[model samples]
Each structure stands twice: as C-alpha cells, then as structure tokens.
Target: MVTIALDPTPYHSTHSLLEFPDVAARAGYDALQLTPHPDFGPFFRYPKADDALVRNLKKRAADAGVRIPAILPVQRLAWPDETRRRAAVRNFRRIIELAVQLEVPVINTEFSGRPDELQEDSEAAFYTTMEELLPIIEREGIRVNIDPHPDDFVEDGLDAWRVIRALNSDSIGFVYVASHTFHYGDRATSLIPELGARLGAVYAADTFDHNRSHGLRYITNPPGNAVRVHQHLRIGDGDVDWGELFGTLAASGYFERDDALVVSNVFGEDETADETSRFQLDRIRQLVDEARSAD
Candidate 1:
C-alpha cells in the first residue's frame, strides 16, 4: 500500500511548526515528510533541534493525529573545507539523534556539493562525511535516502544512483523526483523499473520540459547563467507523464506491499493549501489504487 504524505513547503512561509500539523490534518494528510523550513524554529537547522524541541514536535504531531514518517534536513556535507566538513558531519550526528528521538524511520536529503570544488573532490568529501556519520547511523538503525537536487553537484538522478550504488549499503536508497526527470536524463523511463525496490520513495509533482523552447518561457535577467528553475506543480498542471510514472511504479512492485511512501511535494504559486493538498493526496491514492488493482 502507498501512503500519500505531504511535504509542507507550500505553507513553510506562513505557518509555524506548532501550526503546520493542523494545516496538514485539514488537508487530509495522515503522515508528513517534514522538510526543514525557516519557520520551524530550531528544526530549520535540525541539529539545533534540542531534546525539548524534538519532544515538542513529536507531541505536536501526535496532537494533530498525524505521523512524521520522515524528516529532511538541508545540510551541505560536500564542502571541501575541513572545518565545514567536520561541522556538517557533527550536524548529521545531531540530526540522527533527533531522528531517534522523533522515531522517524527514514531520513532523506540531497547530496550537496561544493560550488568550486571538483566533482571528484566533492564526491570524496561526501563519502568522508558519511563515513564519519556511519557509526552514529549504524548505532541508531535509521534508514537514509538521497535525491539529486537540481542545484547539487549530483543533480542527475542516474548519477545519484551511481553514487548510491557505490556506497552499496542496504539501509541507503534513492528518491526519484518527477520534476527532475530531464536533468536525470533520457533513461528515467527505463531506470524507474530498474530501480524496483531500491527506489524507496517518490516525490510526486509535475514539471515543464525545461530543455525545449518551452523551457525558455521563463528566463533570468543575467542570461546563460546557471539557475535552478522548476516548480512542484499539481499532477495535471504540467507535462509529467502520470500514466507512465504510475504504471512503471506499479510494475516495479512498489504498491504490492505496505510501507511504501509517495509524497505530494506540490508547490509553485498561490494555491489554496487545503485544496492543493487534498487534490494531490487523492490523485496519488487513486492512481496507486488503480495500478494495484490492474496488477
């Protein structure tokens, strides 16, 4: 079974951590993929989420009758500088501790790469940081998932998969974001089925083809510069091949059993929070249900 969870980025700007659970509940979400948002006080930098703060958040979720199945902490662990690298490792340790306290089963994040450092060096830095955190991660028994975020060093999902494969840990997995299909390259259609059980989660949203002239529909003033441009739009609002995505997911055996997580990360413009949340959650549930039935 697939559980449709909400990524509360849409309300990050306006809602507090204490208040977002109620918002998610009103939107009919039973679980949340808690992303680090500025309004979340100490949780914005999860390492700063002290014991008391973690307990408070746990209580808040319990009060709202929602479960926090996962937590996403934004940390740049690929920095080449020794001080920054060490700090990043330390922060990750604290984050794992917070995850233990919150009882969050999965922890996910991007493989942040240093801007000026060579790719090889950044990759090595990431590995080193993870090596440092491995002790804590192993001790706590928390699962880790990673995404190839557009601005990160490994922006391509296939490349991210390569890195994850290199790590070769059973507890580590990939998160395929639909909006990132283009950057991940042409093989996503094939890659989806190949991932099978290794694909631990899906961040479902739609995106325009950012390669063709339609990609030029929106532009930044300083032309030709590298800019991260993409929206986590509602399913049908953009060009995502929903049928193919869902079908491939179904064929991959994702919905054959329980504990599969499909999160609605839709956020672009001014959308009524409740409506957007309900629409995404319902659409995903319906698609997963139909796919399972077809199988």
Candidate 2:
C-alpha cells in the first residue's frame, strides 16, 4: 500500500520531536518523514545529528509503531560559496550515514540558493556538490530525491526534470510537491506525465492559485515585489485537481499503488497543526481507496 507519511513541520516547531510519532500514529499515518527545524536540536547542522539523538529518535518511532521512511535535512545544494557548498556536501554525507543507522531508505532535499544569484553559478555549484557525494551515495545504498522549491534556482517542474535526467543515476529522482503546483506549472496534472518515471515521491497538500486576482484571497504588505506566496491546506480547501492528479500518478509507471512515498504536508505558520494533519491524512486515505477501487 502507498505509505502515508507525517512530516514533523506540522508540530516540531511548537512541540517536541519526541512526541511526534504518537500523534502521527494516532492520526493513522504509516510512516514518518523527519523534517529538521531550528527549534528542535541542531539536526540540520553541518556536523549532522549526534548518534545519541539519532538513536533516541529511532527509539521513539519504534515505540510509537511508525516507520521513519526518510530524513529531510535543509541543506542548500545550489549555494554559490565554494566553502559553503563543500560544507553542505560534507553534511549530506553524514546525513546518509545517519539514515543507514536509522534504517531510513530515502533522503529528501531541495535545490536551494539565493534567488537573485546567477543561475549558471548556482547550477554549477549544485552539480559539483552532487558529483562529490555520488560515490558516498552508491556505497551507502540510499536513495536521493530532489524537489524544485519556490524561489530556488530551478523552480519549474520541467527544469527540475532536466536536472534529474542530467544526474542520470537510478538512485536520483524528482519529488512533486502539490502545494507548489502553480509555482512549477500552470497545470499540475499535465506536469506529472512529463516527468513520468523520473517522479519518485510526492508531497501531498492543496493550495490556491497565486495567479488569481481576488484581493481577499491573500494579502502581502508593501507590494510590487517578485515574491510569490502559497499555503499547504487540507484537500478540497484549495484549487488543486486531486482526481486528475491522482489519475496521472497512477498512470506513471514509476508510481505504484503498492508502495509509494506520499507525504501529507499540510503545514502552516499560524494554524493548529494536529487537527489539520489528521484531516489531511483522512482525506488522503479516502482518495487512495477510491483510486485503488477504480484501478
């Protein structure tokens, strides 16, 4: 069955990481996707998480009866600084080691850098970092999934697909974050088939179309900047076409109903998290069930 994972962003900022598994289990998630935030320990630091903390986190997940399928370290791959990019590569190597210890199969990351920097410089840095980590990734037998993020050097789905193709490794794959639909393309469903088999994981959530002109829909002070804004809302609360998206997901040979990494990421800066997480989880289960029945 497709694994419904709970990302700690829903609670880690306000609550303790130690308490996440139990809440996620109660909410009916089968797996955990650990997200590193500054409020918690320095898990995202270049030195990586200490062994004791990693062991403790694994223990908590086991005790609560959920699996941690992946770990997401907020490392900037496209950073232009030479020294900074080297440090990021070093940290990613350590994260791979930690993943082996924690029995996590995948490590998720983003193509990150100063949005205003030269695109060529950022892309070159990212390629350099990945080339360094290639041997380590192969030896450790871990999968790496990358996503196009808002304001990153590569923010479009097709560009992200090109990066994944250029990597040309079986272990490297693309992640489709539904909340970024508008940022990535005008049509989310259409982009999925284009990525096709290269699409490895999905971060599930709903978001309103940022291009819409309704003044009451959203507000940002001091206008006339290039900033684009969106939120991860529960299903049906936003404008995503869930049915068409799910249908395309099913048609993609890379995505299997029996086993796919689908993370419920309905996180917000000023919203009650647990309730929203539970709501998203239930909605995802229902959708999966419907998809399977149709299949």
TM-score quality measure for candidate 1: 0.92
Evaluate model 2: give its TM-score: 0.91
lDDT of 1: 0.78
Q: TM-score of every model?
A: 0.92, 0.91
- Top candidate on TM-score is 1
- Tens digit of lDDT per residue, candidate 2, span 111-162? 8765688988999998998899877887888888888888888888888788
Give per-residue lDDT, candidate 2, residue 222.
Answer: 73
In Å, residue 60's CA in model 2 sits off its true spot by 1.8
| Poorest stretch of ten by lDDT in candidate 2 | 39-48
Q: Candidate 2 has which clashing residue pairs, if any?
A: none
